[model samples]
Target: MTYSASANRYDTMAYRRSGQSGLKLPAISLGLWHNFGGIDTFERGREMIRRAFDLGITHFDLANNYGPPAGSAETTFGGILKADFLPYRDEMIISTKAGYYMWPGPYGEWGSKKSLVSSLDQSLKRMGLDYVDIYYHHRPDPNTPLEETMAALDLIVRQGKALYVGLSNYSPEQTREASRILKRLGTPCLIHQPQYSMLARGPEAGLLDVLDEEGIGSIVFSPLAKGILTDRYLNGIAPDSRAAGPSAFLNPDELTEETLDKVRALNAMAGERGQKLSQMALAWVLRGGRVTSALIGASRVSQIDDAVEALRGLEFTSEELARIEAILA
Candidate 1:
């Protein structure tokens, strides 16, 4: 069947400016980090993408080393783009990152100009796109000179391979330095992708402040703490859960009794607010306007629906915020 986007897609999801840049991303963007891989069912992954667009999720985030086999997610997404999203390219924001361990040997990863440029070329080929909306350095490379990495990003922009550049997993100091270098090169750092959630408050300590000071928007990943903040684990881990998988990032041991108790309390609070635990978790991340988007990974179409519902109860009073803090404490 032909996929026609919903007419009211633009009416529901909120769009926030990417820093002071011209780009305005949907408040809830879809991330192809987990489920959209070669090992996963192609049809199911395709369905999630279609459903996300119908719900006004215009931004799709990806990375070079996303899939289990690495780069397979981009291949999957490329086929879908050629099939479904090609016509609406102008309406969507697609981003992919380099850095991290992509391949073996020295040049396969990190912040070298050769690695960054070559990785993006491969990504563009796999995704079947001439250019990506935002290209990111997947992480900061301590050994590589910041000037080289930032210059490589600026060169990609100048060469028309990417519209804007971003940084991910960078510390506050690293971000400030990278932003300074990019700005000097006539390409300001547009956005930062950080691991931020109620459970993971590392960014809150200082990363968010640097972004505000530098005018860089943030789209937080793992807003649900790898599904811990969701109801998926409320009754204990299912066999098919990520925690139960062999290569799972979320280990079963992490689900200690104390953690579960906190989760249950948070779930109760969410129930009082007429929301599911997952919905409230997402809303909590976007409560303050500091975060431009909550980048969510969904295994099924229903998960996407739950995430969209989060927008309805995004507001949190001081009391609710304090209550959440106490629970975290």
Candidate 2:
């Protein structure tokens, strides 16, 4: 199906602003970090992108290193873009990242200008696009000079390869430093993609405020905490859950007795709100204005449908907030 065909349904989901920029990202954006990988058939990956657009999700996040075989996710997604979403390319915000391992060699990864610039060109070629809506440095590299990375990002925007620049997995201090450098280069970092969830409050440690002050938007990844904050693990690990996946990001060790107890309490709180744990988790992230969007992943259409439904009642009482904090406490 094409975007014009899906345009009617696309207006159903709310679109939030990206930092101080003119771009407004869908409340629920799809990420190609996992299921839409080389491990799956291209048809399966394309189907997810089509379904997402039909469900009003217009922002697609990807990286050069997403597929199990590195570049295959972009290649697969590029096919879908050409066949289906190409007509609505201007209507969509497609993002890709660098700064992670993509190829073999000493210069293949990290924050160097050589890596970021070359990786983005390869990413665009793989995605069959001339320019991405936003280009990101996947993560901060301690070894590479910060100025080099910022300069590379600025170069992309100036060269019209990427309209905006962003950083991911950056600490508050690193974000501030990058912001200053990007400003000096006159490209200004547009957003920060951090992992935030009811279970992971690391962003609250200071990153949110840093982004806010610098006028950088935040679109949080794993807002469901890799499905841990979802109902999938409330009782026990499901046979098909991430706990069963290959990612070290969510290990069995993380499911400590204390963590499970917290999950149980959170589930009870969800019941009081008349929402599932996953729905509640998504809503919790939207409660604050600082979060521009929640980057989510799904194995099935039902998960996307449920996340959309949660947005219908995205509000919590002060008492409920206190109770949630008490549970997490």
Candidate 3:
């Protein structure tokens, strides 16, 4: 069956400029970090991708180490792209990253030119694409020189393997230096990917400021805090939940009584705002104009619908903001 995208797909969704770059990302993008791998059903993953595209989610994020067996998510995504998304390639922004133990040996990971370049080539082949819209260094390598990593990114752009370069999980100081080096190399940093949500406020302290200062945009990941802010855990965790599964990212122990109490309180506030807990959580992340997009992970098509509805309640009054801060504090 041929997949024809919704005619009004671009009508309702909001697109925001990524910092000072010409690229504009959808306010809500999808991440394939989990549940789109070899371990999961291919049909379900394909349906999620189709549903997301129908809802105007133009960006899909990936990384080298995303799957359980590593790199399987890209393979799965590649298959989907080949089948349904190939026709819409120009209308979408695809991104993938490298860093963090991809292979067994020392050279398999980290920020070396070899690691970053080779990993991206492999990612391109796995995804069956000529070039990715954005390529990211998954994390900062403490031991690798910033010049080498930034140069590798510059080289990628020059090689036409990637159109723009970004950084992920980098601190304020690290971002500043990398942005400086990239600027010197004539490849200005386009955006930054970081973990930011109600539960994770580390970015609020100084990371956002740095991005603003450097003229770099931010697309936040884990905006729901691994489903902690959603109603899925309002009751006890389901046996099939990610927490109950074999995911190292989300564990059953993370759902502490204290966390649940906070989530319940937040859920109540969301009700007052006429939104679901997940919707409110996503809106909260994008409340301020600082964040360019909220990168979400979905196991099902309905999760994408819920996230799109979040755009409706993005604005909040001062009182609501204060109350949310108080609850989080």
Please, what is the TM-score per model? 0.98, 0.95, 0.99
Better of 2 and 3 by TM-score: 3
Write model 3 residue lDDT over 1-329, tens digit each, in one string: 88889999998899999999999999999999999888889999999999888999999999988886699999999999999988899999999999989987878998999999999999999999999999999999999999999999999999999999999999999999999999999999999999999999999889999999999999999999999999999887888887777666687788899999999999999999999999999998898789999999998889999999999989999999999989878
Give, for candidate 1, the lowest lDDT window spanning 10 residues.
240-249
RMSD of each: 0.9, 1.6, 0.8
Residue-level lDDT of model 2, residues 204-267, one tens digit each, is 9999989989999989999988888887776677777757866434677777789889888988
Deviation from native of the Cα of residue 237 in model 3, angstroms? 1.5
TM-score of 1: 0.98
Counting only residues 3 or more apart in sequence or on different chains, how many pairs clash (N, Cα, C under 3 Å) in candidate 1? Answer: 0
197-284 per-residue lDDT for model 1 (tens digits): 9899999889999999999999999999999999999889988876776446687787899999999999999999999999999999
Off by over 4 Å in 2: 1-4, 246-249
Better of 1 and 2 by lDDT: 1
Error of 1 at 61 (Å): 0.7
